[model samples]
Target: MELVSLIIMVLGLAALVGIYVISRVSRQHSPQKRDENIPVLRDADGNELSSVCDDVAARDGKRPSANARDMSDVMMSNVSGKSKGVHQPIADAVALPPQLVLFIAADIEAGFSGEEVLRALDNAGLSFGDMDIFHRFVLSAQGETSLFSVANGVKPWTLVPEELVMQTTPGLSMILNLPSQIDDGDAINDFLLTAERLTADLNGILKDHNQQPITPALRAGLLAMAA
Candidate 1:
């Protein structure tokens, strides 16, 4: 009886140990898929996560892993063109406590720069937002499409070189100045509506300026942002 009990206990512990190891290995190996096309990362709690690519790295050996995003160290990545890739929500990923930071981005067509954004915010009388919001919008254009004539016709938004940021995802967005931080429901609604208006205006400029037909996905994104 005693021997049988000991064997059962050992097997139970072994199973637990195996499960733990598997979980650890999973996190180390699986890259986080970027889902929200909204640009920046907000916690499941709706708070803005630091989108700065502080620790994006591919594994050196057979078992690949990401560069750690601790404040002390920084790394770079070829995939995200930065330090780390995203990891999906873990078990602890619950709706954050009381308040979370919101991420608002300006499309490639909109004039979203530090100075212009500041000018807009100041002109708009908005505050509490920062560079994280305004400066790092990832811009994507049809590389095949030439905008030389369009460039002459209408100047697309430009950011300072250092301010030009990339994302782990395939798309583009801007992280503007954190001059006005809006939290949750109302803030998100206002932000979305405003973004739509900006895109509608940009689409007009693209049509008249470059005689470009905005792609379906781009138009969809614009409409979603507006909605």
Candidate 2:
């Protein structure tokens, strides 16, 4: 009986020791608890998690990634050339913001002298608005066109004497200056109409910088902008 009791006590002690070992091993292999201080980063749609490696690099003050830097440089280059291309606005043809110049020229072989030219200007129903001793003349709008005025003190448009015409070209050229800084679109268009009429009266041709004829279609388009 004593031997049987001794064996039972040893078996119970062995069972308790086995249970302790299993518990300790299971605890050692179990997953650790999540840390609450770490944030869970997600993409824009929350469909997937974003890489936290970038955050780590940023925190360390490292330069941006090579792909990011390359994209930035490309965007900046495009912005730098935005105003330098042929993609200018259509409105610029009629109303140049800074300044606009129109050259009206007539051939001198029309059997008319400079005195006749001055007389035609007087007979063209044009009122003299301003004049400069430097042979600059500002013609006034004869009718409703006179209603428009520029905000600045700048004289709208004037015909200035051309020394070049006096020396060459077998004709006379007049410069119409419309610096918008001193004149408005209405004034500019009104002056252009006067120039065209006077050129026709003097039997002169209106030519542009490239000597191209000023077509009626182009003049109509610019005049239409006033309405």
Candidate 3:
């Protein structure tokens, strides 16, 4: 009876060891667990943006190739034209309130030349105006309605053409005041379109209020604000 008990104990120990070995092997062959908290970027249509290599490069603090950056420009270009049909007039004497702002930053290490930004602004139809910044205006039966404004990304936020002739800035800031006299949807769309155009022309990066690169999720949130 004692011998039988010993044999049974040995068999149980061997079974336990085998189970442990199997678990170790399975774990070694299993895929690594992904971090669930990482934000998944998607466009308006739920299409994913950026590639694994781009993510990896971003994580490593390496600048992505021009092709990768151009992809974002293409995406912006496709949606930038939607604001053309929104032509509601805004009150000329409306008071300015707190504003929602977006940034177009130069991706190059040396930043953007003032001349380049000036030309881009001209092409986008933003004229230097009140407060030393650039303003976009829409003509209507009432008169000219300001759609949005652009300022220098640097401090003072003004674009004095004389100073700009010799100045080099990191980028430009686009500002839109909410709850204004203009149609919110139209204003936002026009603002985005202008920003997109400037970004493409300058080969810059479009950033959110926080100055981080604009993600698809962020883009959706911006569009939703008009709703």
Candidate 4:
């Protein structure tokens, strides 16, 4: 009887140890939880428009701009067909130019050097053109159509190399107006790729329209808009 009791106790202890080991391993491999306090921008239908990551917020030390909030409201109204008294079809809604905006910002302590900014812009295939800003063009059936445009973040936004030399800017704003002559999806893809390249070249943070760090979720949402 004593021997049997000892065997039962050992088996129970082994089971508990096995369970503990499994739990620890599972936790170690589990995905990290997102911070609940991070702000999320959603449309009228509760579809997430964009979100600010905690790490980005900490790094930027800034909140989303009022313009971003206003844009979100405008998008929601467009999506819900509330822009006009009558319900508008999604196809018709997409016909209107939906502006996709992104930002490349330098570190808070220092602004981008004029030489570096000009070099980055040139490398990204932007040419100084209309509005005294830089424009990215793509060839389509209609000939060269504007894919996107880049402007200095500072007042009187222009990207002329000579003008850039006069003043350092904290960032640049890249805007893509959709429903151009080219395919929207292709245009969006090119726009994002160019923005990413410019961001890398300038060593700047790539932020969404809301001026928040671009996360995978935000990227997907932006792509969906083009679709």
Q: Estimate each model's TM-score.
A: 0.22, 0.36, 0.54, 0.57
Backbone clash tally for model 2?
Answer: 0
Encode model 2's per-residue lDDT on 1-227: one tens digit a residue. Answer: 99999999999999999999999999876544422111233344453221222221222243223112222232233333343452343344323322222334444422333454554455654433323211223434542322211110012222222421232122323322333222445555665665676567767665432234667544553444332
Among all windows of 10 consecutive residues in model 1, the one with the lowest summed lDDT is 146-155
Candidate with maximal TM-score: 4
Best-to-worst ranking by TM-score? 4, 3, 2, 1
TM-score of 3: 0.54
- When summed lDDT is taken over every stretch of 10 residues in candidate 4, the lowest stretch is 50-59
lDDT of 3 by residue, 158-180 (tens): 78899998877777777664544
Candidate 4 Cα errors over 4 Å, as ranges: 1-97, 225-227
Q: What is every candidate's alpha-carbon RMSD to the true fold?
A: 23.5, 35.8, 19.3, 16.3
Considering lDDT, which of the candidate structures 2 and 3 is the better prediction for this target? Answer: 3
TM-score of 1: 0.22
Runs of candidate 3 with Cα error greater than 4 angstroms are 1-98, 140-142
lDDT of each: 0.30, 0.38, 0.63, 0.64
Error in Å for residue 17 of model 2: 99
lDDT of model 2, residue 154: 17
